[model samples]
Target chain A: MNIHAISAIYRFEMNRMWRTMGQSIVSPVISTSLYFIVFGAAIGQQMGAIDGVSYGAFLVPGLVMLSLLTQSVSNAAFGIYFPKFTGTIYEILSAPVSAFEIVLGYVGAAATKSLILGIIIMLTATLFVDLKIAHPFWMLFFLVLTAMTFSLLGFIIGIWADGFDQLQIVPLLIITPLTFLGGSFYSIKMLPEFWQTVTLANPVLYLVSGFRWSFYEISDVSPQISIAMILVFLGICTGIVYWIFKTGYRIKS
Target chain B: MTDNADILIDIKNITKKYDNGFTALDDVNLQIKKGEIIALLGPNGAGKTTLISTVCGIITPTSGTISVGGLDTIKDYRDTRKMIGLVPQELTTDAFETVFDTVSFTRGLFGKPRNPAVIEKILKDLSLWDKKDNKLRELSGGMKRRVLIAKALSHEPDILFLDEPTAGVDVELRKDMWNVMRKLSQTGVTIILTTHYIEEAEEMADRIGVISKGRILLVEQTSELMRKLGHKEMLIEISEPLSALPASLSDFDLTLSDDRKLITYSYNASHEHPGITRLLKALIDADIRTTDISTKQSSLEDIFVNLVRDAA
Candidate 1:
């Protein structure tokens, strides 16, 4: 619970992002802008508003959550993987620093990046469409809860991966596909009945819908259900990660 | 066990067994005194690495106890870990980190503050100040090894474990590393190193331990061990070559050279000494004149091979 170690790791990760400003912060903003233009603004002008809200408004929260999820997971995975691939994990293991400190350091930094990217993507979406937060409390709550959950997921993935190729497989095959299928581009209401029910099974749908619910006050699923699901997912992922560090499974052995 | 000083490390009956049914270390007991640099010498698969890793808490022992600075390694990991720094054999370092940040980050891992003065002294001592800003990836292999040493010393630990610190290293850098170790020893750092190079122990260590088959065969002071078991080899090359030894040569147990041009005799450790006058008179009685003779003292290699071969 000491903030000193957390602060040190967070600042170090932030500095790495700053060094790659184009890729980490700017590229995400540019990509989010394009999504708004093609999927929200341009498409909306042709097909009309979605669910009584402006197309840009409907896409805003999903865009922010998408960036938050990808960046948070990838950042944490790389942070832990680099240390291992380069053999610096030995240094961390030999040091007096505890496993809890390492987990906090890596996950805390991942959360910080996710938070920043989420905020920046939100602001950039404003360039394409006028936006307002209908429930300020819901917006802030989901933003943090969502970031922390994915960051923990990232820590687990990082520890599980041994090499660079192993690290890329999870994000590319699992996380990205889940995000797209989770209704980031279209609502489940636009799908057939069976397909809509299947879409409900996607965990990422809960995150995007929960965050979108905060912005537009309308969702295909209940906001409480998605929020509770996220917390449950967070608990499971944290348990797995804490167990890995405590047992020193692959990390130490 | 010498009780001349406080016990820095008290390792009792430690054992390790891998899942593959290979017992890497077994029931090993050792008492290391404060400020002593113990050289653990053994051949390949001798459990030297496993012993060091267990003491440093990198690998957990299946049984037994290890205490450093009077704190049990398993029960009090944090306290014991804080007092020790291990420089592993593999040259794995942060390639992207500059020399300064790498060591400073290691110091911070121990919860030490960013004292530029202390960091500067460590860098300068390791001869890394001029290369402080250079990234690890840019440095040569030897330089990277030096950086690892500097990082291990940054936190000012009481016990330092080096697993093969100089294997495959060039001669000049190896000497440089020994000099640095010497300086650290002068500062009262308890150093334990595992090496395949037996001469390293003869040159630097006060006490040498030979381990084999996951067991400590013997632990003794360098000179004491040598004096107790060492001997001289007397190789005499005669002026005359003979196909076979005469009956008078029976007084001396000797082996004929491959070409029958010389005779080799082990002069000690057999509880017997060959009388040179008797052998010379016997050779003269046989009308075989000796031209040259020389004797060489036994080396650590002789002692190591003798000890391990006997134990095996």
Candidate 2:
């Protein structure tokens, strides 16, 4: 199993995170705090409640998911990509560790970092709004699952990207915009009937809806469908990662 | 061929062809004995690094097989890789990592348990213990090269492959590295190195293998190769100048200097009888007075150039 090898890589990556704590931990925390101040304190007072939940509390799950998704992808992608750029990947490649262990180490570390950030953001939210959790177990479940799934996606992007610009393409252009439109600031039900139908097609909507349902028990879609969608996405990312290792994609040749 | 037990690495008919149809290695075959130091001498783009990379399992061979310690390199790579420690040609390192941490990390990567004692010994051997706490970027190029060596030796592998380990280092560091390699060899670690420095091969390798154009021309004991392919020249200074060579010395392969006071005779050193005595007698019979005589043998550099030139 090469457990030692996995832990070595894991510790190395975690150490890098600690070394860059300002960018890794503090930046996301500050950004989430600003979201609470601007959106929850400033804007929520001017808006009415939806589905019997306060507007400020309704934004909590969506905002946390927003940061979780972006952080997970960027953390994992940059972790693998920097090694390739610096030519240090040869050490890992020539070592006795297998592909699975390499992925486990890299993705596991990335998910852990995102999970920590997500929890911190949740704690920061308590300072701005009155938060509630109808299903605390499911809320934690959704957080861990979402972090892992997006981290795997980030790992794939890291292997696929050839340049630093490409590393930011997915997180900045795709994920951030999708999160804003995926019911982070408002409920999709508040939209007109036609727009509500279009919002359902956005994959981020499923993640935010499923995560929010665990908090307020009010969702745009059924809770079962959200779980199914997340599991399916996780499976797809796993399959792609397996194929990449098998084919020796950008990481190998 | 020796017994299988004595053969540590057996490479047979190995070829590596890149995707662009360039053949980096062509039907290469070699057998390295345990604890012997062999040098692969070649110029740039001669597949020296590719050969080392393939044996280290960094690059997959397009065809053929390699077995280390009787275990197939492809099928049993984990076991085989555990036995090899490679010091690569490039100076790739994490600038942010401290010397001690990077070396220890590599040991763990090879599945070795944490042994600060072993890491400390290697660092001290390479003269890197003083810089152990410094970030890699803070060290000089020579010191970074030493750190690379320390990392390679951290796992205490049975075989070590040094690919141009002294490429751009100063002469002092080069000599220091040679001494370290000698000590490792004394410890029964089989060492294989590829180098552009002919003197390095001549000074360190027990056997020298001349490779050119994706093929191995020959591999022979250093002393034996010198004797077999090396030539010798004898210079004879005459007591007086002459207009041309005397007909009596026409039977010998000789060339006279422009001043006509000196003559040179070239002969194969491998011959049992080089005709030196006969040539002296013939010179006496021809009534030519000799002032002084001296002989010079060819160096490994000369033989290497000729071999590579002929192969080309």
Candidate 3:
């Protein structure tokens, strides 16, 4: 199992996070807080309620999801990518650790960081809007699942990227825009019928909808479908990761 | 080449061909006995690093097999890797990591429990204990190289591979590194090093392997290799200048200087009778007076160049 190896890698990564606390913890917290002030306080006061909930409270889950997805992807991606860039990856590659343990260490640390950030953002939301949780267990479940899934995607991106520009391509170009359009600022129901159909195709919609349903019990799609979609995404990412280790993809050769 | 029981690492018919069809190693075979220092000497792009990397399990061989301590390197890599430590050629390290933390990190990566006492001894041995808390970036290149050695030794492996450990290092530090390697060898750690420095191989290696063009030309005991391949030259300074060599000297391999006052005779050192006495008698019978006579033997550098040139 090489449990010691996993613990070493995990602790090394977590130490890096603490060393760069401003960028890892402080920056995300401040940015999400600003989103709350601008979207939940200043703007929500002028908007009407949706699904019998205040507009500010409705934005909580979506906003937290938005940060969780981006942070998870970036954190895990950069964690692996920097080692490759610096040529320190040889130590990891030549070590006795297995591919599974390597992934567990890197992805686990990334998910933990995102999980902490998600909780902090949720706590920060209490300062701006009245929050409620109808299904606290499901909310925690969705939080953990979403963090782990995205962190796996981030680990893949880290191995796949060959340059700094490529590292940012997925998070900045794809994830951030998808989160914005995935019902972060408003409900997809407000869209015209045709647009609502198109929004359902966005994968981020499933994540946000599932998470919001756990909070307000109001969702654009059924909660079961959201869980299924996420689990399916998790399966796909796991398959790719397995293939990566087997084939010695960008990480090996 | 010894009894299988004494062999610690056995590499047989190993070849590594890259995707682009470049053969980095071609049918290489080697057997390293336990606690012996073997040095692979070659020039740049000679597959020295590739050979070491393959044995260390960093690169998979395109064909053939390697076994360390009777365990197949590919099938039992975890067990094999636990027995080997490699100090890579490049000085790649985390600039933000402290010396103590980085060395400890390598021990853990090898699945060993944390032993501050062991790390302390290694750091102190490498003269890095005083700088344990200093970041890697704050250290000089020599210090960083020592830290790399400390990391390799942190796990207390049975075998250590040093790839150009003294490349670009100063002479004094190179000698210092040699002393450290000698100390480790005394502790029964089987050491294999790849180097471009011929003197390093001659000075430290018990056996020297000359590799060229992805192939090993020969591996022999350092002293045996010198005696077998090395040639000797005798310079005879004449008491008076001459226009040409005497007819009696035609049987010998001789060359005359431009001034015609000095003659040089080249002979194979491996010969039981090098004809030095006969040459002196011939010179006396020819009535050629000599002012002085001295002999010089070829260095390992000369033999290495000739071997590589012949392989090319």
Q: What is the lDDT of residue B293 in candidate 2?
A: 98
Model 2 spans with C-alpha error above 4 angstroms: B233-278, B283-298
Native contacts recovered by model 2? 0.75
Residue B15, model 1: Cα distance from true site in angstroms = 1.6
> Residues A107-178, candidate 2, lDDT per residue (tens digit)?
999999999999999999999888889999989989999999999999999999999999999999999999
Q: Is candidate 1 or candidate 3 better by lDDT?
A: 3
Flag regions of model 1 displaced more than 4 Å: A1-8, B228-230, B233-297
Identify the leading candidate in terms of lDDT.
3
RMSD of 3: 3.8
- Candidate whose TM-score is highest: 3
Q: Where does candidate 1 clash, by residue pair? A: none
The two-chain DockQ for each candidate, comma-separated, is: 0.46, 0.77, 0.79
TM-score of chain A of 2: 0.98
What is candidate 1's lDDT per residue for A98-119, written digit by digit as tens? 6778778888888888898898
Ten consecutive residues with minimal summed lDDT in candidate 3 chain A?
A244-253
* Fraction of native Cα contacts reproduced by each candidate: 0.48, 0.75, 0.73
Question: Tens-digit lDDT track for model 3 on A50-160?
Answer: 999998899999989998999999999999999999888888888888899999999999999999999999998999888999999999999999999999999999999
Pairs that collide in candidate 2 are: none
lDDT of 2 by residue, B1-312 (tens): 678788999999999898899999999999999999999999989999999889987888999899999999989989999999988898889999999999999998998988999999999878888889999999988888888878888889999999998888889989988999999999999999999998898889989888988899889998887676558999999998978988988999999999999999999867989999999999999889999999888777778788889988
Best by DockQ: 3
